[model samples]
Target: MSGRAENMIQLIDVSKEYKMADSCRVALQHINLTISEGEYIGILGLNQSGKSTLARLLNGLLKPTTGQVLINGMATDSPQEIRQIRQLLGMVFQNPDNQLICPVVEEEIAFGPENLGLPPEEVNKRVDWALELVGMQEMRYHAPHLLSGGQKQKVALASVLAMQPRYLVLDEPTSMLDPLSRREILEHLCRINQENHITIILISHHPEDLLDAKRLILLHEGSIYMQGTPKEVFKDMEKLKAIGLKRPGLYQLIQQVEEEGYRIDDNIKTIPQLVEMICRI
Candidate 1:
């Protein structure tokens, strides 16, 4: 996270509830958070932990039942400002099928910018740029529905990237992907955050999916349970297990080794770092 970057998203005492036939279900309860520009944040939780609800709140897909959500200081509850808010914030959901609507890949990627009424030349530039960013330039003319699952997800991502949003929010974007594809998507997110300086708010239940995040916010039931960097938050293994979240296997192994008095450098995060630590020992 950059110290000088301004706050791009803020949830001030936010809560959301859904009305059923006879009763109401509280999906979120008083979530107060701030995400600064150029930060990669992970929202971790099990099912029914308000992860999806929070994601929707950020971009004004759903208004808060109580409190407020602000994007770059613009209130989401304000309909007049919502269009601009959404333009500044882009969301990528779990299923690519829900987002991909165009017949061709380039057309799908150009949808958002085109709707913004950009000139043909500018739209074409964005379409080409987004496709290249996601490595989908080769498939620009291909039909979106016929692509493989991973490819479809990439196309979906390219579509959002074409909008060139300042903040990107992903809700379980890799849940439907295979292991290799999931890894690829996560790597793409990390690269986007670092190279483009776009703020990334990734929601997932998998700890491994969030390893690249600069900070982790753990949600339980309908409120925030804990928040910190990956090392700080995942250190409480028993607490995470109690909340129905699993730590990555490598993280578990490293924790156990450290428990036995082995000195593992705090800077060591990935497998390569762990291997180097072991070699030195």
Candidate 2:
């Protein structure tokens, strides 16, 4: 589905700096970006490359040291506007254990709307909807701590969804889960973006997780090194390796096959596509 053409989030010349005891470190430097409504964007970078810093800036968790972060035309730098900005942006972190607060799954999902002083009826409606959206309706009474890592992440996601934010910023939300769980979370995110019309900003290191994104942004040393579609970005294996990122195994294998003087389609992404190319050869 195509996102609304207008900019939903804008970062204009944004930079973030942290002041240590004796020195100041720049986490992001003069970064400018625009995210349209309902867009699915993946952010990739090595450790300390400012991925998390960028996420925080989008949600008003951290103010930019120099530039402005605008959420739907509202500036996040204003203290009074931070709350409003946060209501429009929801953030899911890497660890679900740290984010889930309530004991039961249902309460955890309702916590956000309850804090907003929503009526009990509205809160229940939101809780029910969020639970169903994440496919955790059966686990409403389950203890979050006892659930598997993937289930816990889903609950955490439900909590964020209950808030009904226009934008969702995920900071490596699946890093702790197993591969199956990671895929589940990513699939749910895609559904959320497409069906729910929520803009998704996913920060992940896994190439597979980024394949479905409409755009991919690569960060290096606090700057945007490259930004493009997954096919466009991953085409340059040497550049990805230089940035401490690896090409998908399938892509690497395709490269090797090409080197052996075999003709293969470079644009192929899925296994079936590869199989068809091999059969044709």
Candidate 3:
């Protein structure tokens, strides 16, 4: 939980550019990053900040225009390794509907392993395990369309988890949900990363969603502007404000209380923790 496993996703001098009839656009520029196995990281950026482009580049959905993307030393651009790379690195999108293709929940969870040519018995085991992992075993027979937004997202996550990927990259996954649903999804992600030891690269614009991340990578206009722990990055209110991101509500409150001559632990995350600290004072 403190350090990471050996395998890594390396991006070296990577850039992505789009070409139209008469002009070109750069989504990412000379980006370099390394994601180690079992590490939970957050990628933060505003809209059009190349967060989605970066996520797609991880699983070989998009090739970098300039440099290299290597998954455990296998180049993502290689036709032979792209399939394996994708299998090792699963992706979840902003909309659950976009990823949940199968009609039933169990089938959706089984789809990845089934396509991997796993044995029927193995596939069934994976399906059951994934459903339980996401706490969706009771809804295994439910239709995807009938489920709530949060349930649908859980099914989508279970579908990816069924494949047993070494790394999971999610792009604005909780953006479409209500606050409670969003919190639920983020909590599930924390549990998934901690319990299963799967490396998680969570891409989102919301600072609140990334509070559980072990490391934070802040992207501004497609380049990494800052990288640190959530405590380190969120404490710089002026810098975050300049980048169009606000400090999380809880952190803001902590700062305000501290400014009023109260001491709060740096690890305080919830309102109850702050309340307890105040009561102690």
Candidate 4:
């Protein structure tokens, strides 16, 4: 959700399809997108709107059945080819436990670089840097099973970042955390993007999650329904509601104010921003 704006990955005529019992199940179609480096994009849409499938395509987990996902000018094919692409792109999942296959935290973070055949010094350096990046260095020796839900997810992200991936593909990375923990994880991610200039592509449903995006893209029925800066996209409150997307609580309050005969800009995107606008008015 709330994201930065920088593109690092590009998709050219990307599409995905699966064979069903009697017909073909098309998951994505003609997804032509450009993800600039160091940008954080919040991808939202209804279920089965190709959000998840799109995330899989970014880091090469699932290859497009039709087109190609170009990662830093390289074409990817299998999981092995993907391994090379992943050197620049990293993916974090919704469920941290599923991603945390190893028992210890450091081991999980090291798995990626080790697989890439880096020297022990390099792996150790990455492990240290990534842990420090996510503020998880102290827990490197802890058991994954013993960590909190938010901690686990952060650890998963650190594992990916340790690979020094310039592009980070996150599929609902905060979905499972409690509200406070969710905020914490998102804040840390924002710091990573701002300070480290890492590109972030986040797939999420919550409008609140998208508050920080330099851009927001909504995928609907296998196509882009809408896309713009959060202020632009969230302005279409009625349209978003029609698509089962809830506006932020602050937005709803502003809508209420407008209906009550108050003159409002109707373009406010966040609670604090709205407050500032109202104060000046």
Clashes of each: 0, 0, 0, 15
- Residues 34-144 of candidate 1 have per-residue lDDT tens digits of 899899999999999999999999999899999978888888989899999889999999999999999999889989999999999999999988888788889999999
Q: Candidates 2 and 3: which is better by lDDT? A: 3
User: What is candidate 2's lDDT per residue for 62-146, written digit by digit as tens?
Assistant: 9899988888888888888789888899999999999988889999999999999999999999999999889999999999999
* C-alpha TM-score for every candidate: 0.95, 0.91, 0.94, 0.87
Give the TM-score ranking, best first.
1, 3, 2, 4
Q: What is the lDDT of candidate 1?
A: 0.90
Candidate 3 backbone collisions, by pair: none
Model 1 alpha-carbon miss at residue 68, Å: 0.9
The whole-model lDDT of each prediction reads 0.90, 0.89, 0.90, 0.82
Candidate 4 residue 267 Cα shift, in angstroms, is: 12
138 Cα displacement, candidate 1 (Å): 0.8
Regions of candidate 2 where Cα sits further than 4 Å from its true position = 1-7, 253-269, 276-281
The residue-by-residue lDDT of candidate 4 on 1-281, one tens digit each, is 12222234667788899778899988888888887887888898878889998987777777789887777666665555676777788889899989898989999999998998999999999999999988898999999889999999989999999888888888888989999888888888888889999987888977787777778999988888899987678779888878888777876777666677777664565678778877786
Where does candidate 4 stray beyond 4 Å?
1-7, 78-81, 253-273
- What is the lDDT for 226 in model 1? 91
Higher lDDT: candidate 1 or 4? 1
Instruction: Write the number of the candidate with greater lDDT, choosing between 3 and 4.
Output: 3
Find the 10 residues in a row with the least total lDDT in model 2: 1-10
